[model samples]
Target: MAEQGAPQRRPSIHDVASHAGVSAATVSKVMQGVATVKPANVQRVFDAVERLGYRMDPLASELRRSKRRIIGAVVPEFESEFFGTVITELERLAEQRGYALVAASSRESEAREKEILARMHDWRVSGVVLAPVRNERSPAAAFMKASGMTGVMIDRVLADNAFDTISADSAAASAEVARALVGNGHRHVLVIGLGEQAATVHARLEGFRAQALALAPDMRIDVILSESDVAPLRASLRDYFGKGERPTAVYSLFLKGTLVALSEFRRRGWHCPNDISLVGFDDAEWMQVTFPAIAAVVQPVRRIATQAMDLLFRRIGGEEGPSRALLEPCKVLMRESVGSPGGGARAGGGDGQ
Candidate 1:
């Protein structure tokens, strides 16, 4: 019998083994799920564990295994609605798989993105999901090659096919937007984009331009590809609106781009459809709640997140095959913001202040 006023010692594997009347090795084999252990011994070990309240140390067990159940993810930025949703979905999926997920944001810096990849490699993560800042020869690909890191590229895709990639069908979706604008008699169109160097944005620009001109040979399409900074975006939008031949319809290729254009147009007292029709790439919540309810495209972020983690786990599990570049289609939600060009309103021109 234990003495009163004495400290209680935590139950250990040895205690469980003693309670089960088996060797410590047998207890460990049973706990680790080794199939060679006898059925009777397995039952005894479970019963002893329940009685002694002996729980295996997860960290110690991970150390004993060759691969740690840890996944790392790096994105260009966390503030964006798209990336934020992806991260949240990935965390939930990883937890369901009995793995811990670590997330990092690069703030849209190529150097910072590479640094995060290096740190993830150093940590010996089981796998990584990387949304690189640069689409052209991403430094992440080179770093992964040198470090022998296993990962899947998300959002921005590389041309070299160096790794498995998952992204929305940006070109198709952007082309659909152009088709809608041209169908509505919008010959004069404006496209607001960000980071022309990015693969996703570049694809959108080309897709819109190609489709608009193909549908209407004489369409006048003006494109403004600005930096991510709001100052540059606002300056370009103001300059365009202040000049001659105001666009009848505008297609914004990014969420922030859409917001900035809407704000600038409102500040200039220009109303939607009556003055200008608008469409955007991301279907943000406010887009739905606005007075006119802006038309926009909805990216399949949940599917992208799940597929990326699935491919990453396959690689971690030693599956060998040619890397796949999968493109998921986006859904376009057209609201009241898109309409035919106004007859007399189109001719009404001012300083657009």
Candidate 2:
């Protein structure tokens, strides 16, 4: 029913504003879901936008305005529960402060991370929240600095000095868990899935090793590098168990590593807190709902998200100061998975009843 060769006209906020007899700012406010405008005015704006088929130009007109109101979030994985929660909190805070959020995930690859950062730059985002992968830093950091883009590094430290950073006290958190295990009378403990030379991983390993040495000066620690190498981890576990000198407890650095170790332990019919104690970093959703609740050091996901956004906004507002590094303390959640070292300790199960 439409003419095939008709010239198509691109819609603009100005067109909608003209039709609604309002200012461009009013139309922008309406599009952003600002509640300050009266309902009748909002209806008028919506009607004009619908009639004109006005698609939002997030990069050019709306976001790049002189006020600096668009915030970009770059994370490793959007699907992870921790990052998902962070995104939610950041968006909520940004909305309350009359700013918009544009988010992207790097999928744990350095090249992808650079591509996404470039895209966000084209979007003219005033600020960015990044969780970069380790061992790679180049023109991206330079671009962020030279382009005047205020940035905050979340969950990981950046190798370059271009952005403010906010992360948990990894070393202290790991030390606390190790100390807890030692206090429970466990001497021999194994640390699993610490990657090669990552900033966060290294901090955790250092903390764990420090506590282990303080308690038992000559205690032997088995360090497993590749968490994804399930066969090697299983082989190590089997060998340790078979030698009649099994570690009394295991500390996993990541959720995936924790899951793998737990699955292997379960397959062997070994009970937690009785056969061996367990502690993990980063609590997952199912951990709370499972039969045996796992003990963990809970990172302040919401706080980190909110603070990162706030810092970014301040920087965008021309607040000149030295780049800051915020280290949030983690809380240890004691659950049934950890118990006294000696045998005959009752294995505590979750509230599955």
Candidate 3:
């Protein structure tokens, strides 16, 4: 147990050189049988290396002899649990496979995303996993194609049928959540979130609307396109709810959008599952801890990332052919958020508020 707490890595050539008070090149010369290395300096280097139990990083040396082994990944957001977990897991896998990861958050900007791709290309990264800014033929894709780096797209794909792609089965997940809401007696539903931007968002909205309308043909579904800045969201929420009958249920399409909805509900002094029901598309840890413990569609973040990494590795290994796509399903976490249209929290359950 005590040993477990100690540093796991063996001492490196640099460490040995530092201990011997010599240059790394001097130590390298000693290791490579350079006769010009003074016997005394060589002896000191050997002594330091033995004392520290140092070993050469063979993979690092070999990769230098071959090519850059760094994999670049760019995501739209980082503070969210989903992207954070997926990127961290990919980094772990990359390190295990003797490759390095250089990750960046594009913050959902096309310009920033393109810049990241350009920088990664200049650095000659072995591959890249990109969560693009839009679902279209982008300058970023053109950059990747011209650079010839094995690229695997993640989260929202920018182009379909042209490259390896991996993402959550958002359409299925949306349909599932829509069914849950409709079945729970939510007749008038308000769909608000940042889902009007990309292909992933469009698919989710289409799936939810289709399934929900099929379930209850008479059900009403309204939408308010949300901006990242909460001020616009607040204005939209106030404008929509002020003029019309309050929605029986509010469905937030993204994690950040869910937060905006929660804040608006609080500002209005509204109680969930009492006067209005709430359901969000993306799950968050705090979502389960908050008042009414909001129900959400839980994305298979780890599975999607694993599949993406697998595809990226295949692409890096020179797998040639048509693009591949893996669509994994998301699950629903039914908490105390949704209930009947006019009724409060269900019997036997404490209102989270």
Number of the top-ranking candidate, with TM-score as the measure: 1
lDDT of 2 by residue, 119-163 (tens): 888876767888766522434555676777768888866334567
Please say which candidate is ahead in lDDT: 1 or 3: 1
RMSD of each: 8.6, 7.6, 10.1
Question: Which model, 1 or 3, shows the larger TM-score?
Answer: 1
Q: Model 2, poorest ten-residue lDDT window?
A: 344-353
Q: Which stretches of model 3 miss by more than 4 angstroms? A: 1-66, 346-353
CA shift at 330, candidate 2, in angstroms?
Answer: 0.5
Pairs clashing within candidate 1: none
Off by over 4 Å in 2: 1-68, 135-139, 158-160, 227-245, 344-353
Query: Considering summed lDDT, which 10 consecutive residues are worst modelled in model 3?
Result: 344-353
Residue 262 miss distance in model 3 (angstroms) = 1.4
Q: Model 1, 6-70: lDDT tens per residue? A: 88888888998899999999987665435566769877987888777676665986878765667
Cα deviation in Å at residue 251, candidate 1?
Answer: 0.6
Give, for candidate 1, the lowest lDDT window spanning 10 residues.
344-353
lDDT (C-alpha, whole model) for all candidates: 0.82, 0.74, 0.77
> Tens digit of lDDT per residue, candidate 3, span 1-353?
55867877767778988999999998876644345667699679878876886655656655654446678999888988888998998886565444678999988787888899999988877778888866645567777877776788877763466678887888888888788778778878998867377778787888899999999999899988754455687688888777865888888878877888778777888888887888887888898888788888888888888787767766665567798877877877767877887787655443222
TM value for model 2: 0.75
Quote each prediction's TM-score: 0.81, 0.75, 0.80
Give the lDDT of residue 348 in candidate 3: 46
